[model samples]
Target: MTKYRPSKNSDGFTIIELLIVIAVAAVFGALTAGMLANATDIYSDSLERQKFISEVRSSFFKIIREATWQKSYTSFAGSNNKKLNIYSTDGKSIDYEIRNNNDIIQNNDQVSGSNNEILTDKIEYSSSNVYYLDQQGTGIDIVSQIENVRSLKLDFQFSNDTDDLRLQSHTLPYNLRIGRAMSYHE
Candidate 1:
């Protein structure tokens, strides 16, 4: 009968090796979980910022479009401060004031006789020429006093017909370009 000798090395992993492998796996799992959590947070923040910017832009354009269609009031005084004192539909009260300072103040007292409250502040514009609602419904923020503006541009389109040309002669631009560059952090 031939005698069989046992090998020095074990066929399977020892207890220590198994423990070490489990520890390494646990570490890797923890790191992966942390990275995933961080990524989720960043994505959520980006989405929120995007939504905020969209709301701001939408509100701004809506105001501009309305102002463009309405008749400008030239008889009112103290309205030349590169700010628009937009009155409510009732005509008895001011709704909000869009100022060249990039502030949107709501006149709470228009009908209630309350003072104006700032709805938004620190608005940054891309154009150096800040457009505000003048007292007369005119866009008159044409001075270079506005600082930190990244860009400013003006465009005018003329009518093709002679009758329309007369109307266009006295009219300001129907469209305005406003842009700004700034970083917003939340």
Candidate 2:
């Protein structure tokens, strides 16, 4: 009877084949890890943007509420000027001025002359923007350039035509959108 012998080559994968398999597995693992990392980064950025937007909206609404409740200035400038002179939140002062240009200037706290404090920057007028002020009256990270902003209407609801407000309605009739696109380059 012939001696039966098992071939070594048929027993399992060759060393080269094992190495190739390992390389493929390593590549797949790397890809998966990279994808996961990218997703995490995007999620984190979205959260931060949402927080910023919420804060901006809150500040704007607060200002509108105050305007509606106080209703200090019937006219912007005068009886025929179409402008109103309203006192600032701080009762001791009456230096806050709202102009026809939709710009608000809060004068500095002084017993005499009024120094302008621009609440919203020039770029923010056209765009639905948010402004952050530092302790030194410097603006930082003014996120303007909104996608679309047709109108930003602030209506003061009064109990009667006398401008004594019972409630206020702040409406963004058009798109009230805000976003930031970030690009990365090696």
Candidate 3:
């Protein structure tokens, strides 16, 4: 046979074709990485929001319990509209207020042990969701006590740049409503 010569139609990839394939693979890999990073960010944000909501709910219930327990001596503190004062017979008093303009703070000087309790670190105070009663029987802004307030409404809001979670509850010396209803019935 003469010098061997290869056919042009061989069933194999050329250098240009191989290079194109590698480029396409690299593009796909980049896209996948970006997608994964975005997903992780979303998951983290969701988890933070859930934790914030849980804390708000737990704090609301805790305050309700404490307010109920102090029903006998719960009173609207005249000095601070945002604060609800509970005084025991022994002169010890506990003050509950939304401090730092948003976070709930409990000043339990009445307790021989323990200090102020921070109800929650995440509060969207600027949302205008929190409210309290004026001296009258009407609901009003927490920052302002118009008259003889009958109760306080603790409306907590937790939020991130994109989402918001809120919970609300009213505080009335536990027996106030019940006692009033009973008297009316009698």
Candidate 4:
């Protein structure tokens, strides 16, 4: 009987070589997955910041408009200048309030008993300054002196978890911009 020997060159890969290839591929796959996850988180954070700014800007403009246009207010009271009840003769009323100690600001327009409102829970309330006009159109914010005054200014400080913005507003006059000179001349 004679023993046969096999050649050194083989047509297929060795078991050791196949195992190494699979291990390298798995490491690359894991790295790619991690990168993708990080990119997704960055995108989400940017979107949230954008939304926060938009809502803050829009609400600020609306509040300024109300301060300039509305001729009367039913009440103004609260710590750090929060809460305003607008005066309306049309049997409906609108109320603006900052709730929960620097957390949120809300606008509630009540037709009868229900509240129609728009609010954002993300705005961080810092502080607000309320100013009013007397019969002579002087600015005041004292509660004791409110009966003889008109609203003249609204200084609002709004914030998100990431940033802070201060919006200072001044109305034209106590008469609500009625019948004023159109041009200034030398």
Candidate 5:
């Protein structure tokens, strides 16, 4: 009654065990693939969003900088919210407006024919209301006259398929003056 012998089938794993192991491995592999795909999609979307934001910021910076140096502001062609005329110190004028409701056009040399520069194409819809700030920082509409304009406010929006970004800049014009009397010492 003291016999020790190993079974013949113990040399390798059974077919059922092999099948179970393969099925488990396949499930894990599929899960990993799915997660990778999801991460890739998220990364792609994030990149697109970042690019859009960068472009918008760049456009705004250029617009604000130009507006800061504007010596004159006027409405364009009897249109208040649709267009603007900004004059620099060198007597050159530029127009800022939305063309066809989608393009941010900056027309340099408004006295000439069509020198439009596209600032950004992401403008789905935009409208600008230029308010002239008084000495007390009150916003007053400059409908047909532009005098004593201390600052100008430009509010606009940019949009893509799934997102919208709104931006505003209140720029002090370079030609603002208070006309104070200077005291002289004898």
Candidate 6:
């Protein structure tokens, strides 16, 4: 084997080559930064949406569960029509109300501690969120005639700043349907 020697013209690096490499690296860095920023924004939006949905859904289910065997129900008057009072046969009363124009709160007077809970801060401030329904599913004015109300429909609009979600739920008292038993999902 012959001994190999390096070429005399082979220098370490040229200024132009160094500058070109730096420019390419900078371009790649900038692109990576932009993609990272976009990903962060997407993650933030998704988290917010999930939190909003969780809050609203949990609150809704809590109300449904508590009122499943309600003996009587009433609504607040005037601008608080959306607020409700549910009473059980055991005299336990639970009140659901909107406070500060956005937050949905639950007050269980029967409980001594932890009686008050902030359900969500995404509910739209409106008096029409709760609708009292008759046996025929017709909406009724609770303030005027609440005696005929057999069920309730919750029509809430929740927001996460980036998007808005509307949820409508109609709850029929399961126990009240005595002989007309139906599946849980039905």
**Cα lDDT tens digits for candidate 5, 1-186:** 989887676778899999999999999999999999999999999999999999989987777777765654442223245466677767787777766658788888745775777888887563444455656777755664455456766777788898788888787766554332235510
TM-score of 3: 0.60
lDDT of 3 by residue, 38-152 (tens): 9999999889778766877787677666665434322444425445666544556676666656676777876665457776766665652434564455776433543334565
lDDT of 2 by residue, 56-139 (tens): 455355555433322222112221111223333344333334454645455544355656755432212232322222233343
lDDT of each: 0.42, 0.40, 0.63, 0.60, 0.70, 0.72
Whichever of 3 and 5 has more lDDT, that candidate is 5
Write one digit per residue (lDDT tens) for candidate 4, span 1-186: 888888698799999999999999999999999999999999998898788788877876666665554433324433125565554434344566666565445444545544535555544455665567665767766476655555466777777777777777766433334432245710
Which regions in candidate 4 have their CA more than 4 angstroms from the true location? 1-24, 72-80, 88-92, 103-110, 114-118, 122-126, 133-139, 142-152, 171-175, 179-186
* TM-score per candidate: 0.47, 0.41, 0.60, 0.57, 0.75, 0.75
Largest lDDT belongs to which candidate?
Answer: 6
Report the C-alpha displacement of residue 178, candidate 1, in angstroms: 23
lDDT of 5 at 138: 78
What tens-digit string does per-residue lDDT give for candidate 1 at 137-166? Answer: 454443432222122222111121121111
lDDT of 4 at 46: 89
Q: Write the per-residue lDDT of candidate 6 for residues 5-61, one digit (tens) a residue.
A: 977896588899999999999999999999999999999988978887887788777
lDDT of 4: 0.60
Specify the poorest-scoring 10-residue window by lDDT in model 5: 177-186
Which pairs in model 4 have colliding backbones?
none
Distance (Å) between predicted and true CA of 31, model 6? 1.7
